[model samples]
Target: MMNFEMPQFALAAPEIWLGVMVCVVLVADLFDRSGEARFAFWLTQLSLLAGVWLAFYTHWGDSGQTTFNGMVVSDSLAALLKAASAALAALTLAYSRDYLRDRGLLKGEFYLLALIATLGMFVMASASSLLVLYIGLELLSLSLYAMVALDRDNRVGSEAAMKYFILGALASGMLLYGMSMIYGATGSLLIGEIMLAASGGENALLLAFGMTFALVGVAFKFGAAPFHMWVPDVYQGAPTAVTAFLGSAPKIAALALFLRLLAEGLGDLQAQWQVMAIILAVGSLAAGNLFALVQTNFKRMLAYSTVSHIGFLFLGLVAGSEEGYSAALFYAISYGIMAAGAFGMIILLSHKGFEAEQIEDLNGLNDRHSGYALVMLLLMFSMTGIPGTVGFYAKWLVLQALVEAGLVWLAVLAVLFAVIGAFYYLRVLKAVYFERVENPQPLVSSRGPRVVVAANGALILLLGLFPDTLIALCRAAFGL
Candidate 1:
């Protein structure tokens, strides 16, 4: 007789809870006759809140615990990332609510899809096996694909969705193939076992090939250059609400994926992967900054900015140390907050029959509404990595990690590109404070979104002013 032990399902309490709520929200939305989708909206928010609570409650103290036969993990990192992802999702939904309603895109499906995507992120954060991570990635990717096309009436949106789908599928296939090769070489699907096999330096040639493909997949996911063709088009074409969601929470999940697959599983191959990371980092910084300079479209410019920020995030990975990983994690979380605020401002300025997609549309914003303009100013400053903002601290941490790792030239190069990136962000502030238009439209107002946007902007400054607490939390996630 063979003896078997039950998998400890409780370790994944947050994921399980979120999975249940995704179904509950789906069913609740079906019965909701309110054309405004009030029930579904609030229910989704409640679900997110519960998910955040569960993440911390279940895993706050855990250093690390693998369960589900080593397919899933509960740890400080997973707990923090999951909570942050869920909170960002809630904020994204909050910011999108009024904008979606005004544009007639407010529906139960949007809320449901967002929840499902959040659930996917949770799974990704906790996944310990390559197969489990791939499953989570697909769930997140497919939901995002659908969300991009939710505005079916928009041809540009449909085209963007198709492009995104094809490219995303291709990337997924490459990632799976890479994982298969790794499994074949290591004779195991588990990340720990892969690390053990890789550290032995047996089958070095095959392992290198598999790692190369895996790096490409990771680069594509991060919107790093050479594989970042989809970012600008999708960001510009999707509804502002969808773009806002895409810009924020999914980033935390991507960071989770990067840490798991590269920093954890492939740690033994650090020298090889670190060199590749440096190449991606430099390429992304140059391309993202240079391309962004000419973009008149606000969303497209931010998309390139995102690629550049990913470059900075990669600098930490290039360091290949635990402190570097924590620094990268901090950068990811900070960027997510700033990105949300940036997109939220776009949504705030837009109204029925008007889209605030162009940089010129922001002219005389201060004259029209000083308060909102101030918030926009803060976001722009932060994105520019100016001193006394979270963006600055985030960039500083990455550079510090680089210096510690003896990559002084790379650190200096990053600073140069960062200086180049500042121009476009300054142009945004110039429009807000200096430029005047013939007629400025009144800013739209929704109590919920307005308050959230205000808090979001304040957070950038607050975190900048006192970053140690969050920094410590990030370090703790790595048991440093």
Candidate 2:
């Protein structure tokens, strides 16, 4: 007789709940003849809220738990990142509501796709097996590809979708190949087993070669430089609503992917990945800052700005310690909040038939709506790493980690690039306060988006002033 035990499906309650809700909302939207997608929107928001609660409720234990034959894990890190991903997804939808409605792009598909993608992020956060991680990643990527092309009328959107799909497929293939190599070398697909195998040093050259390809895939997902050919074009061509979602929540998922595959599974190969991380960091900082300086498109400028921030995030990873991982997590969440607010500002100022894509679109913004101008001012200051903003502390933590690791020279180089990045952010402030527009239109947006954007700006300064709470949480997640 053979004995078998059932996997603990309760460990993945959040993902399971969200998956069920995706179906429920999809079916509910079919009955909504009003065309406003109100049913789908509210149901999706309810689902996310429930998902967050479930994630915390189910994963609040002190130690990590692996189930489904070690294919999924429930841990402090997964709990925190999963909750953050859900909250950020909700924020993205709140900011996107009016923008989509104005352009007649408000449909159930938008909400449905967002929920599905978020569920994918949740899965990625908890995956303990390489195969499970890849499945989650593909789910997220496919939803995003469709979301980018949601506006079927726009040729640019379709083009961006095609480019994203092709490049994304190539990256996925590389990642799969790398995973196969690692599996062949280690004779296992579970991350814990891979870590054990890597520590033995029996297949050093093969592991290193596999890691190279894996890193390429991770870099592409992060929109990091040398693999970031798709970022600017996608950001510029996609609808602002979609851009807002793309630039925010998926980042936390990317951070999860990096931590799980590189920091956790391949820690023994640090010497190899560290060198590669340095190269990526330097290239990203230089390319991102330099290119952003000359860009006239606000969305494209932020795309490069994202790349530069990724450079700083990489600095933390290079430390290869618990503190370094914690700092990177802190930076990832902070940047996600900042990015949401920055893009939300663009959506807030826009109305029917006038996409606020250009940098000069904000001319005389202070004269028109001082409140919104002040909000944008706070966001720009945060992005510039100004004192009394979260970005400052986020950067500070990364630099501190690098210095602690005795990489003082890299820290100094990062500071230089950060200084260069400040100029473009200041230019945005100048456009808001100093530049004059012929006739500035009144800012028109719903109360929900307005309130969310205001809260988003306030949170940045609040987190900066007292970052210890989030820092402690990050450290706790890593059991440091």
Task: Give the per-residue lDDT of model 1 (tens digit) for 1-480.
Answer: 956778898899988988898888888888888887888899999999999999988888796789988899889999899999999999888888888888888999899999999999999999889999999999999999999998999999999999999999988988888888888889888898999999999888888888888889988888898889999999999999999999999989988988999789889999999889999989999999999999999999999999999999989889999889999999998999999999999998888988988999988999999988889888988888888889998998999999999999999999999999999999988998999888776765878888998999899999999999999989999998
> Which residue pairs does candidate 1 place in steric collision?
none
For each candidate, the alpha-carbon lDDT, in order, equals 0.90, 0.91
TM-scores of the models, in the given order?
0.98, 0.98
Clash count for each candidate, listed in order shown: 0, 0
Model 1 TM-score?
A: 0.98
Candidate 1 wrongly placed segments (more than 4 Å):
none
Give per-residue CA lDDT, model 2, range 1-480, as digits (tens): 866779899998999999999999999999999889999999999999888888878886537789988999999899988988998899888888888988899999999999999999999999989999999999899999999998889999999999999999999998998999999889999999999999999888888889999999999999888998999999888998899999999999999999999999999999999999999888889989999999999999999999999888988998888989899999999999999999999998888999888999988999999999998999999988998999998899899999999999999999999999999999999999999988777776779988998899899989989988888888888997
